[model samples]
Target: MRLILVNDVSTVRGGATKVALQCLEASKDAGLTCAILVGDDGEGLKPQFAGIRTVALGERPLRDGPTFTDVFAKNYNRRAFEAMEGLLQESEEETVVHVHGWSQILSPSIFYALAKHEVKVIVTAHDFFLNCPNGGLINFHSGDVCHIKPLSAACLATNCDKRNYFHKLWRFRRTLTQWGVGEEFWSRVGIVLVHEEMEAYLRYGPLRHFTTLRTPTAPLTPGPVEVWRNRRIVFLGRMCWEKGVRTLADALNKTGRTATLIGRGPLLVEMQRALPHCFVPGWLSDEEVARLAGEARVFIMPSRMPEPYGLVAAEALMSGIPVIVSSSALIATEVANNGAGLVFDSGDAASLADQLAATDDDDLMRRLSEAAFSLGQRIAPSRAEWARRMVDIYMGRSSFSAL
Candidate 1:
């Protein structure tokens, strides 16, 4: 069987891109003929894909200084359509196309080309692009999660975009073009949700066929974290308003605790100015982050928005570090219910501070740490198991029924 992995970028810069590469590497290991289709210039392609087949469309993202051509190109990229059609034409064996990310560069036109092919198409719902025009299901203007049905009159009138109404209108137009691909094309498509809780938000979307797939997780570390002796709070993600970086900063200040904020974003300058006692290192490698995790008493995911799946929280849990998740996170209830983590009000600094204070108890810390480490393994499949599961789905041997 042949496997075609599609994504916006070819490198491991973002979570979605990393997941796509993992799928590619695993498919190759499983002895499946694998190829990659990238929407960008594919700069700094990883060494693992050195000899593998790859097609990189030399196109700029619409957000990067868009031109007059981008007005229509962002809706339906004709070049992407033709190129994908060519790939489908060349395939002689049964093929499966798994698309990871497309909204930024490839556009919705690739679906038009796939309409002509008889291959199976699986789209990983890494974000809410399948339904919400903004791809986050968030009201950027109000900084709140949106529940209105996508593309409805209410959705059309609301200026929920991060930019302005004009940008929202453009996104709505693009979403309409994507939906215009028709029911027939969508019939062959299956939605793969990274988290089971995602179904609650996306079940009513246009796409019907759905399956829950565990994103592969890194193996657990040898020993549990020594939480009782640690005092540093660690947060690993983009420093943005939606991520509740400001909230975390306020909580830290309230509790007189120092934290290591390990990420870079628009809020970097502001955070540096406000938190003199905290360490605001811009970004770190996975190895660096893992090393720092050993010294963290607790990890916090203080997202203001309803996070689809907080992967960093899972990583922290796997390290046996107790997590403090905001109620907005989809995994918040599970973490709380399993006694693995504490949950606070979404944007309440006081609530987050209270949770942070609770970690002072050595006995409570040990209990939470042990629970987190034990439950972390069930959050996602290992790398090899994820590959085998994908192969099963590709071969129609999956027992997963539509939700």
Candidate 2:
């Protein structure tokens, strides 16, 4: 089988890029002819694989925020469109095109090309961009998660775009285009969700017609869970609105629990001011993050939004540190099911404080720690096993066998 992976970045950058590379590497290991196409913005669009082929489309638009370029090319990256048309039609084999992300750099035009080529396609819903115009299913103006039907009259009226309404209008037009893309693509191929809770029917009731598979992203196993000292709570990722930073600060303050905010973002200064004793240690390398997480008594992922896949929670489990994730995060289901940790309401400070208070329960912490370590092995498998499962899906042999 020929596996063609596509994404916005070529190198390992964010979660989507890492996921694309992992699947590409795994597909190649399964003896499939694997190739990847990326929007090479001078980072060389090169991955670290030996025999796999890498195709680099030209650089993406230089503009970042509001611009005429964003309106025109953010949803219709022309260079990527031309490149995909050439690549898809070049192969006549039973090629399966697995698209990881496109809204950021590659745009939705490649879906049109896929429609033109009639290739077998599978879109992994890394985020809500495929369905929600604002990409986060969030109202940027209000900082609230959106529950209105996508593209419905309510969705059209709400200014959910991150920037101004003009920008919202731009995204509105782009998302309309993507909706067209989704309308066509969903009829032809499969949709791979990272978690079972991410079922599309929950969001779009009619989307139940699609053949969807739930395959959580492979997790990373840290060194064996060891006894450590830092009893303070830890928040490891960026300090942003969607991460429930303000709500976390309130919880920490209410519970009077010492904690460390490990990354930087817009709320850092404000959070530091509110919690004078909370450690704000900017950012750290992966090794440092692992060490800190390993030592912490509990790791927290208090996301306000409906997080599609919560990798940090899984990483925390791998470190043998029990997780306290917002109930809205998809991984919370996994952790709660395995008795690995606690789940609080998404944006409720008091709910989070209750969980924070439970962290001090020595017997509860001990039980969670032991359960968390076992759950880690189930969540993060060896790379080879990941490859085999992926191949099984591509070959139509299974639908994400349960853990």
RMSD of each: 1.7, 3.4
Over 4 Å off in model 2, which ranges? Answer: 42-47, 58-66, 141-143, 182-184, 201-229, 254-256, 264-276, 380-382, 399-403
Q: Against the unseen true structure, what C-alpha lDDT does each candidate score?
A: 0.85, 0.73
Model 1 scores worst on lDDT over the 10 consecutive residues at 214-223
Q: What is the C-alpha lDDT profile of model 2 across 52-162, one tens digit per residue?
A: 676777555332333566567776888878888877766677888989988777888888888776667877777777667777776766766788888778888887775
Clashing pairs in 2: none
lDDT of 1 by residue, 83-199 (tens): 788888877998999999999889999888888888989999898898789988789877778999898999999999887899899999999898898877875588888887787
**Considering every candidate listed, which one attains the maximal TM-score?**
1
Q: What is the model-wide C-alpha lDDT for candidate 1? A: 0.85
TM-score for each predicted model, relative to the true structure: 0.95, 0.87
